[model samples]
Target: MKEVKIESVFQVYEGILELPEDLQELMQKAIEARQKAYAPYSKFYVGVALLLDNNEVVLGSNQENASYPSGLCAERTAIYYAGAQYPKAKILKMAITAASQLRTTLEPIPPCGACRQSISEYEIRQKSPIEMYFMGERGKVVRSYSLSNLLPLIFDKSQL
Candidate 1:
């Protein structure tokens, strides 16, 4: 048997202020969206901001429900809305952030597994990569050039 290895790489910024102007703007929008999150159960608010190929920005926040599995994550909500509203447009970038009543997580907030698969579908459909920016504690940010970096060997239609 042959053993194979995979590696993922990303950049970490000192803080949001150190990011580029556009990325900083996107992060700000994510923060604003977080304010609207309806997470009464977890009390952890998550927000996502997407930049479409048409230069339009779309925002989404986590929506929780009484049924745990019925709730939707901020990333999926934003991605679905973008897909429905701008079917022809490609998602170029996405910024994600989260806040908790307890304390600020001192690490980048990565998308859940289900969200990663959902995001991979769009990337495969658009035939391009979607840059991602994740927020961490003390304004720290993580930048990833593509979803593949986060979800490698992903299951897609190509496998079917």
Candidate 2:
């Protein structure tokens, strides 16, 4: 029997100031999008912003529903919008931020498994890596990983 280990690779930036100009702008847009989040249930507002190759930025905020599952994450919302509006464009980067109702969640919020898969699909479709940046309400950038980092061993369309 052979034992194999999988490693996750990522880079951590000191803060938003260290990000590229366009990425910093996208991150700021994600923060601003938080205000529009409809999170009556979780009280956890999440915002996502995506940068497309055509120099277009798309923003999305979490929308909650009473039924729970019907609600969608900001990442998926923004990504889906990009797919519908800019099908041919490649996704370059994504920034995400989250806040809690009680207090600012100081911990960096990670995406749910489902959202990771959704983002992975787009990355595969575009045949390009999508850089993901995430931070908490206030802290150093918690995590920054490429699309390949989050969805290693992904089943691409070629699998079918």
Candidate 3:
């Protein structure tokens, strides 16, 4: 018999102002993008900003569809667009922000499981770590140094 333990590491920031200047800027952009999300059903808005090695920033907002599973998350939307537009660029960092129209979200909101899987694909493709920062409408922000930190047991092409 064997026992295995899995743990995820996250860095907590009291507020956005506590972050570095560049990260503060990225978080602001994420907030702006979040306003454009089309989450009429859930009333929860999410936005993501991707920073590429080429010094380009791509923004994405959650788009909801009438069919529940038809919609794509902000993480995937930004990553996919960045992939199509900057095929040669390596994504260096990503900032995610989410807010709910129904109530004030005062804690960090991490991406869903599906988002983690989708993001792993890009991280694997670029052969580099993607620093991720996520936060709610207000309050604390959380950071993951690498996608691996969030999904310890990543399912990559090796599984195929």
Candidate 4:
């Protein structure tokens, strides 16, 4: 039997300025969206912004429900909205940010497992990678990585 290997790449940045201006704008929108999160339960508000190839920006905020499992993440919310509103457009990139008790947290906001999987679907559907960005309360724009990098060995329709 032969062993298969998969690898991914990510680059940490001092801030969004290190990247393209468009990416910087996306991150800013994500941070602004954080203010609208409805996360009373966890106090961990997350915001997501998707940049469509058509030059549209979609925003999402974590919505919590009385029943924990019923709630959806910001990433999915934004992705779903983008899919519904701009069905034919490709999602070029996404930026996510989080806050707590009126202040941003120190740690970079990472997408949940389910978010990663959901994002993987778009990557496969679009036949292109979706670049993702995240930041911490310290205003450090930690890193950027492709969805494939985060969800390697993903189970797509190919498995069905």
Candidate 5:
């Protein structure tokens, strides 16, 4: 038998000030969006802001429901809106942030499995990588150059 290994690398930034101006703005917008999240059930508010190639910014906030499954994540909400509004525009960067009423989640918050796959689909369609910035309520952040870094061995159309 043969063994193989895969490694993922990302950068962690101390605070929002460490990010570039555009990324900093995106992070701020994400934080603002989080404030609008309707997370009465979980009280875990999440927000996402995406920067398109055309320099347009799109924002989304998590919307929860009593049924639970009816809710959509902030990442997907923003991504879908970007896709619908600017179908031809390529996504350049995305910033995600989360807050909770219970406690401060200090670590960078990553996307869920479905959101990762959704992001990967756009990456493939755009024929380029989408930089991701993940931030926590306390200001800690992590940056990834590509969705593949978070979703390695992704199941894409290429496999078919």
Candidate 6:
């Protein structure tokens, strides 16, 4: 049998200051949203800000429910809101920031599997890549050029 390989490539930035002006602004917005996150149980707050083709900046903060799986992630929260508010607009970029109240998180924190899949749907629907930038409280940031970079073998509508 022949062996195959799959690679997920991304750039590492020392800090938010190294990013472009637009990205810096986007990240700042995400950080602000993160502060508003309701994550009393986990104490791990996450925020996401989306930049759409319509020039609108949409923000989302993780909302948790004591009822376990009832809560939604910040990524989906922002994306779904964007989809409903501007169905015709395409998503251009997404900035994500996560922090833990218990400690100082300094490393990049990638999106959970569910978030990746949810983002892949939008990427496919828009027929374009959704640039993603993710990081923790204040430190190194990771930049994925596309959602495919994060979720290589995405389960899309084509499968169903």
Backbone clashes per model, in order? 0, 0, 0, 0, 0, 0
CA lDDT, every model vs. true structure: 0.93, 0.85, 0.94, 0.84, 0.93, 0.95
- Candidate 4 vs candidate 6: the lDDT winner is 6
Better of 2 and 3 by TM-score: 3
Error of 1 at 58 (Å): 0.5
Report the lDDT tens digits of candidate 2 across residue range 1-160: 9998777877777788987787788889999998799999888999999989999999999999999889999999999999999999998888999999889777667678889889889988887888898887756665555766866777767888
RMSD to the hidden true structure, all candidates: 1.0, 1.6, 0.8, 1.9, 1.0, 0.7
Candidate 4 lDDT, 50-142, residue by residue in tens: 989999999998899889888999999999999999999999989998878866587677789999999999988998888888876446665
**Which parts of model 1 have CA positions greater than 4 angstroms off?**
none
For candidate 1, write residues 8-55 as lDDT tens digits.
Answer: 999999889999999999999998999999999998999999999999
Estimate the TM-score of every prediction: 0.97, 0.92, 0.97, 0.90, 0.97, 0.98
Q: What pairs collide in candidate 1?
A: none
lDDT of 5 by residue, 28-82 (tens): 9999998999999999999999999999999999999999988999999999999
Displacement of residue 75 (Cα, Å) in model 4 is 0.2
Candidate 6 residues lying further than 4 Å off, grouped into runs, are none
The 10-residue segment of model 3 with minimum total lDDT is: 4-13
Q: Per-residue lDDT tens digits of candidate 6, residues 1-160? A: 9988999999999999999998999999999999999998899999999999999999999999999688999999999999999999999999999999899999999899999999999999999999999999999989999999989989999999
lDDT of 3 at 139: 93
lDDT of 3 by residue, 47-121 (tens): 998889999999999999899789999999999999899999999999999999999999999889999998999
Off by over 4 Å in 3: none
Give the clash count for model 3.
0
Global lDDT of model 4 = 0.84
